[model samples]
Target: MAALMIQGCGSDVGKSVLVAGLCRLFTNRGYRVRPFKPQNMSNNAAVTEPDEQGRRGEIGRAQALQAMACRTPLSVHMNPVLLKPQSDVGAQLIVRGQIEASYQAMAYQTRKATLLDLVLDSFRRLEEEADLVLVEGAGSPAEINLRQGDIANMGFALAAQVPVVLVGDIDRGHVIAALVGAKAVLEAEDAGAIRGFIINKFRGDPELFDQGRREIVSRTGWPDMGLVPWLAAARSLPAEDAVVLRGAADGMRQRVRIAVPILRHIANFDDFDPLQAEPDVDLIYVAPGQPLPADSDLVILPGSKATLSDLAFIRAQGWDIDLKAHVRRGGCVLGICGGFQILGRTVADPDGIEGRAGSALGLGLLEIDTILGGDKVLEPCRGRIVDGQAVYEGFEMHIGRTTGEALNRPLLIREDGSGDGAVSADGRVSGCYVHRLFDAGTARAALLAKLGGASEGVDHRVAVDLALDEIAAVLETQLDIAALARLAGLKDIPT
Candidate 1:
């Protein structure tokens, strides 16, 4: 029952990617490994199996990918507490993959203490199943303001008795100070839990940073695990944050321009990563105040953590007006999950699942109405394109049940004899609850063909696997893999 926790100096410091790469590295060495995060604050979720009574669960997308890296099935225990932000001050709480409650920041802070036991219970269950458990911590343990009820960082490490390896992002600059300052500020018990530190995303020669590394080791008394170089292969993997949306529009010379609006509460925007990788596609994530490109071939409304709120937000940004003009100009429109709910005639939140209990008028692009109050549908599904034979695989994670005339012209026909989503009569507008809808090669090609763009059609799943292998190969050379294994108390190391 060996475990190692990867905490970071700050958010987006590559803790998730490091844990994922290590998971693959150890699994390749014939060790049974599992990835766990006691708490995750992200809307990029993955759907998993239904419970005995036919209810499904959701976990963060990073954990889902790490599960793949470990060659294991996805489980809710991989991420026990998920916080999906509905607004700047509030988020929906999920416990062990089930929707628990939605709370404001202060309210959640007070409530998190109650959930720590559940988080450790899940960690214990995972420990019983795997030889090595790679745990990823959320935010930074140095966040003293958040240390009181902190199930996300050092608190969880101390409670679970897992050794911690602090990761600092060199690409973000001030790596030395960030690492040292963390050690300086943390309470002694929390600071003592840190066993080592790793500098990630280094650009230049490693030898140049020798003095800097020494400074950190001398100051913090933590050994250097490795200085991980920037992994370009990580670009192929799905990003877990909307911050990646900033530069996603750059380096686009492709003929077909697919524009997606960056919603404030955007979730599962990684649905477009495969499109971004396509040679013939220019995927532009339209920022706020930036209108959807009028000449673009397609405008996709991506999933949102808060459907009604984001729908209103897009309207405020006047994107709805741009979408109408784009539709009139013959540009295609596609909506996924929450985005799909917004394409309908109306969205009703009678039970206030998203926010205040009320009905909001939708974009009216599809002849449907959505009632947003129900057990969230969370399941992986396989289906064929409604008007085409191309098969596609994706998962659904939404709380709305849609009903209307447009449903008669569903966008997909599930293998289970069920239908999903809807398509407009002219075929220019469509919507579906599926995320990762573009991961299938044939389906991606067929969808691009509708916009008159040629697609070489790379299977996204295959691309992810190759990227994982590439990362593992790099970490094998750069990182002290044997030292890490020993740190995790792995006794029978594969040569």
Candidate 2:
């Protein structure tokens, strides 16, 4: 029944990575641990098992990775409220892993109050099943402006009665002020919930920050948990936010240039992590106003939370023109999930499932037409590239059902005797609903070969595990694990 919540001074402060590392560290000590986030605002989601009602749910990708770190099965309750942004002012609300509704920013502010009970119910269920529940808070609790209906940070901590550890990112600078400022602004009850503070992503010697650490402890009366050094292994992990998408394409030495447009509502962009690790590949994330590199060997349209909107966004950016030109130049094109939907001749959303009820013209690269409705497909799949013998495995998470003449030339044949994706007659264009399509060793190599590049043929899943282990090892040496265990109220400690 013990729980500890990791809240941060601001967004992108590495709270997720810290929780994940701690989860792995404690699990390695033979403790049953689980990761939970009462609310998450991100489009990077992972599909989990079906609930009691037989409906599959989706959680934030970070929680799914933390579940792997804890060696536990992922549950929708791990992340009860997910906000998938569809536009600057609106997002689709997901309650217990199923789409609930879409609301504008101001509308959601009033609506979130009603969902706090649901968040707590999920937390209690998870608490019942584990020895230690590690909770990750979204954004800063210091936003007293957001304190009224806040289920994401201090509000959830106080409601769930979980002790909080405030994490500050030193790499972003002003670590001392950020930590102290949080204490200064938070209401007494919320401020008192924080038991300690941990400074993360420190670059230089920890000793140099002794005075700064002492200043924070003296000003806030919260003990210094530890100052964690920079963890390079975190780079190998899938990024859960688009903030990391910047500068990803800079300074590449690889021969094969593969470009991906950074959509406004990009979902599950982690599918390219495997390609990013390839030595012979240069994975460029093309931002708005930046044309898809003409010298690129391939252009990939990544998954998006809002297909029609992003399709419009690409057209507005003139990327569609760039893509057509790239195709004419013999460059290969691949689309995943929402991206796959856009490659077809037309996409119909009669029910307004994604947005306004309407049909949008697609890129017409594939002879398919997609109807955007139906229960979202959420399941693991195993198959092989139809054009080659390379085997692959990944998960499908999309709401569109596609059918057309292009079905006769599918990109992949699932093990379940089903075909999943369309391929062009000339074999230069392909699209599929599968995410993590490049994680399999043989499949990655085969795909690269088709684009005239050689792959080292490494299994991405194993690489991710090794990276987690490495981070856990670093945490073991840097953090006060015994103190953290005691803070978490672990009755028994393993040697």
Worst 10 residues of 2 by lDDT: 246-255
Query: What would the per-residue lDDT of candidate 2 be over residues 1-495, giving only the tens digit for each residue?
Result: 878899999999999999999999888888789999999999999988889898888999999999989998889999999999988899999999999899999999999998999999999999899999999999999888999989999889988888899999999999999999999998899999999999999997789999999999999999889989999999989889899998766746578899999998899999999999998999999888888888999999999888898899999999999999999999999999999999999989899877778888999999999999988888889999986789999899889789999988889999977888999998889999988889999999999998889998989988888989999999888877777777778788543
For residues 251-337, what per-residue lDDT tens digits would candidate 1 score against the true structure?
455688999999999999889888888889888888898878878999999999888899899999999999999999988999999
List per-prediction Cα lDDT, in the order shown.
Answer: 0.90, 0.91
lDDT of 1: 0.90
Q: What is the lDDT of candidate 2?
A: 0.91
Candidate 1 lDDT score at position 72: 94
Residue 488 Cα positional deviation in candidate 1, in Å, after optimal superposition: 0.9
lDDT of candidate 1 at residue 77, scale 0 to 100? 88
- Candidate 2: which pairs clash? none
